[model samples]
Target: MAKIAVVAANGKAAKKIITEAVNRGFEVTAFGRRAENDTDAKNYIQKDIFDLTREDLKGYDAVVDAFGAWTAETLPLHSKTTQHLADILSGTDVRLLVVGGAGSLYVNPEHTIQVADGENFPEAFKPLAQAMAAALSELRKRKDVKWTYISPAADFQAEGERSGKYILAGEEFTLNPAGESVISYADYAIAMVDEIESGKHIQERISVVGA
Candidate 1:
């Protein structure tokens, strides 16, 4: 059985992914910040992903990095943790597959479709978005750990039904009209687990959207 570790498995998406992966016979260790809300996974390890050591990160075939938040202040959480994980998992064969923000996805004319409306979207949101972009900049500098950064749908969130259908693209990516790339937390989990099993798209960024 493949051993998998889901860092920051606290969200609906992470919970659903761990659940589905466990049902598929994968030995999953769902790690989260708090132990109180850990009934989501079959077996949960309560720990902060940022402080995870090599010993803690070892023995896992791959890591699904669902450790990020969408806010005006804690925008750099994902990338900072990514830096930490990169250090821990470096010089080893452990792979890091992360759930990234869609702000970095390509828009027309090579611009990213950031959450920028000047006023409606808080100034706070831009920094975190830019921080994630900076985090990706750092990720590209590494040649050690096999990294695959996956972006969420434009409408990827707590809402929406589990259609189990979405589109996957590499590098430059985006959504269509009426949020064509929307995928529920369940389907996003499914896609992440699927990617982990296949071990494809190493050291690259991919985006997903619903049909």
Candidate 2:
């Protein structure tokens, strides 16, 4: 079975990914700063994201980076952490999958207007959004590392039913039949794990939306 390690494993999205991976019969290890003992995984580790070494990460088929920071002061950690993972996993078979933000998604077909620059984007979240965008930029520069960034829809929700249905798009924001950009975290997790298993979008930034 494929072994997967989920960083920031206790976060809502990470938890759902862990559950979904385990349900699909993959071996999962939950890595978090707090290291909860109650997760339904094969293993759990409490460690800082930067402290993870190539040796420590060996044997896992893939690693999902579910880390997030809200404040402007802590937002830079996003790029820093991405660099660390890229440095450590460079030339290795382990793939890095980032849980990215929608701010980087292009608002138009010409690739002109990111969601972060859109008028409706909340000011309070712009820092975090910009930080995630920076992380994706950094990842793009690492050609030796195998990585995929999955950006959720602009209306990504924490509480919604897992219909087990979603549409995946490349870089651009995906909209459902209602012309709304939205996706539930549960379904996002499903798409994420599906990519890990399929390796369909390696070295690409993909977006997910409700079907």
Candidate 3:
């Protein structure tokens, strides 16, 4: 079984990933600022993400950076936290799988426009989106660490249905058969765990949407 560590494990999306991972029999350890006794992961580590060292994550097969910050003042933490993790895992074998934002995914085949650049993109979310895009941009510049950024659908629903099906795509944004870019937290968790076990997209950014 894969020994996985999920940062920001107490969050809505991360919690669903933890549940799916645990159900799949992975040895999952939840890492966060606050320890939740009710968390579904097999183990828990209470610590600030910035304070985590290489030693703290030495044996894990993969580290999922499910860290998120939505407020205007805290948005920059996206890039900072990602850089911190990359710095600590520079020369190691552990995979850094980031739960990224869809805004960074290109909306055109020419690689010119991103979802964040679309006219319909929400104004309130631009800061958060830009911050995540920065994190991904920075991650792309690193060659020492093995990384994969998984961006959820443009419409990432916290309480949406889990149909046990999804469509995974590359850096360009894609819509499902229904012509909608959406995915539920539960189904997205399935894709995350599948990627962890398969290691299919190292050093790449992939997107997932409902089938």
Best by TM-score: 3
**Judged by lDDT relative to the true structure, which candidate is superior, 1 or 3?**
3
Candidate 1 on 1-211: residue-level lDDT in tens?
A: 7789888888777787788788789998888888565644567878987678899988989988777677756776767889899889897888898877766766555544544423455565677667777787788888988888887775676766778777776655556556565777777877887888888888888877776
**Cand. 2 Cα-lDDT:** 0.90
C-alpha lDDT values of all predictions: 0.77, 0.90, 0.93
User: Which of candidates 2 and 3 is the stronger one according to TM-score?
Assistant: 3
- What shift in Å separates residue 173 of candidate 3 from its native position after superposition? 1.1
Q: After superposition, which runs of candidate 2 have C-alpha atoms over 4 Å from their true positions?
A: none
lDDT of 2 by residue, 24-77 (tens): 999999988994645678799989999999998898999999998887678899
Residue 165 C-alpha lDDT in model 1:
74
TM-score ranking, best first: 3, 2, 1
The sequence of per-residue lDDT tens digits that candidate 3 reaches over residues 1-211 is: 9999999888999999999999989999999998564579868889999999999989999999999998888999999999999999999999999999999999778998999998999999998889999999999999999999999999999999889999989999999998999999999999999999999898999999999
Give the distance in Å from residue 198's predicted Cα in candidate 2 to where it truly belongs: 0.6
CA lDDT of 102 in candidate 1?
Answer: 67
TM-score of each: 0.86, 0.97, 0.98
**How far does residue 162 in candidate 3 sit from its true spot (Å)?**
1.5
Candidate 3 lDDT trough over 10 residues, lowest sum: 34-43
